[model samples]
Target: MYTLNANEAKTKFGAMLMKVQSEPVEIIKNGSPVAVVVSLDEYNKIEQLKMELVKSRFENIDESDLVDGKTFREELNAGKYD
Candidate 1:
């Protein structure tokens, strides 16, 4: 972990951001660790993992159960229940 004081972080914000692209950067305030910055690639990987988890929750659902008595427009318009 790379540590940077608040002032240094602010002054070199762009370079610090670039460093975070390779690994995490820790921001310290008053000698205490406050926050972390990570790359977008890492963030998106986490998001994709979350989506996969949500998708897994529906993995066992049958196609018939998913489409039961619902027209495409009715489903699209949120009127399927009626």
Candidate 2:
């Protein structure tokens, strides 16, 4: 990862964007880390990994563990997910 303070990132946005084509860039503000800039290819790979993980988990579930849509919605509205 490459690191840049907020001011540097703002002033050198084009350079930072170019750097991210090869590796991720870390952005900091007030001496604290705030964000990462990655190439679209990297971002898409991450999203694909997330989807695969979710699909694998769902595949492992038993039908008995499944909830109907209405019941799931009711539980969700009751803050069960929170």
Candidate 3:
């Protein structure tokens, strides 16, 4: 991981992007951390793992706990997985 102040990040934006390919970059503002920059592949891998973890957590739930049909479909498509 790498850390950079906001001003330094802005001044070396392109170079920072290249650096992110190897590891995440933390951006700080007002002397505190604010954001992280990661490569697209890294972001995708993280999201996929998150989704899988969410799914696994529900695997042991009883069928009675789930809503029926249309309502379930609606919630499923409404970003409820996250």
Q: Write the per-residue lDDT of candidate 2 for residues 1-82, one digit (tens) a residue.
A: 8999999999999999999999999999999999999999999999999999999989879988899999999999999999
CA shift at 80, candidate 2, in angstroms? 6.8
Give lDDT tens digits, candidate 1, residues 1-82. Answer: 8889888899999999899999988999999989888899988998999999999989888777665444766786886557
**For candidate 3, what is the total of clashing residue pairs?**
0
lDDT scores of the candidates, listed in order = 0.86, 0.97, 0.95
Each candidate's TM vs. the true structure?
0.59, 0.81, 0.74
Return the clash pairs for model 1, or none: none
- Per-candidate clashes come to 0, 0, 0
The stretch of ten residues in a row with the least summed lDDT in candidate 3 is 63-72
What lDDT does model 3 reach?
0.95
* Residue-wise C-alpha lDDT for candidate 3, range 1-82, written one tens digit per residue: 7999999999999999999999999999999999999999999999999999999989889977878889878988997876
Instruction: For candidate 1, report its TM-score.
Output: 0.59
Q: Which stretches of candidate 2 lie over 4 Å from their true place?
A: 69-82
lDDT, model 2: 0.97
Model 1 misplacement above 4 A = 57-82
Instruction: Name the lDDT value of residue 72 in candidate 2.
Output: 97
